[model samples]
Target: GESVGLHLPTLSVQEGDNSIINCAYSNSASDYFIWYKQESGKGPQFIIDIRSNMDKRQGQRVTVLLNKTVKHLSLQIAATQPGDSAVYFCAENSREGAQKLVFGQGTRLTINP
Candidate 1:
């Protein structure tokens, strides 16, 4: 039970501040890890990815750190802006089942004025 029950649907953020979006998963045997950003009514876009062998990976303005020891992952966005507002998701491939990605409860990232 790694799901967050705080505010479902979405989250509100400022127009120019860093935003940290979180995701909780259910499985415990997932290996591959990936982060995706999706805009309003659009498909997800790959931002960054890291295999189970690694612990952390960084992109242009984004960073993904994984904690296999805790089965948790997070995304850090630098220089937050309205353009960076989107639904961020952390997905992992199934360990032994279908091997498809089982997405966690997504946190809707909102940017304020």
Candidate 2:
């Protein structure tokens, strides 16, 4: 199965600052995406997503962008907060019926005061 990976293992941002997390995927056929945020002792929660047809999508304080030409994906957080600290992951699926999603090796985001 194809895999997704992050360029960085961790990121730190000051409060009220914006942050960008990057991911690279091996599967060019992937057409669906789901960005997830995971905190300690909890399951991954969906943050935002962008389909292959769209280059970008925004939700609340978060934004997702896809570049199929480079097989890259990114998540932008508008404002960093203490509560925003978590491990972020990007999942990709080829959109085939019942296909499994490949998740990136999460990047830990830290919010600095």
Off by over 4 Å in 2: none
At residue 108, give the lDDT of candidate 2: 100
Counting clashing residue pairs in each candidate, in order, gives: 0, 0
Which candidate leads the pack in TM-score? 2
TM per prediction: 0.80, 0.96
Model 2 global lDDT (CA atoms, 0 to 1): 0.94
lDDT of 2 by residue, 1-113 (tens): 59999999999999999999999999988999989999999999989988899999999999999999999999999988899999999999997789588999999999999
lDDT of 1 by residue, 1-113 (tens): 33322125577877667776655555566678778888888999989987878888888978888777767787878878888877877788856556577666577888889
**Residue pairs with clashing backbones, model 2:** none
Give the worst 10-residue stretch by lDDT in candidate 1.
Answer: 1-10
lDDT scores of the candidates, listed in order: 0.73, 0.94
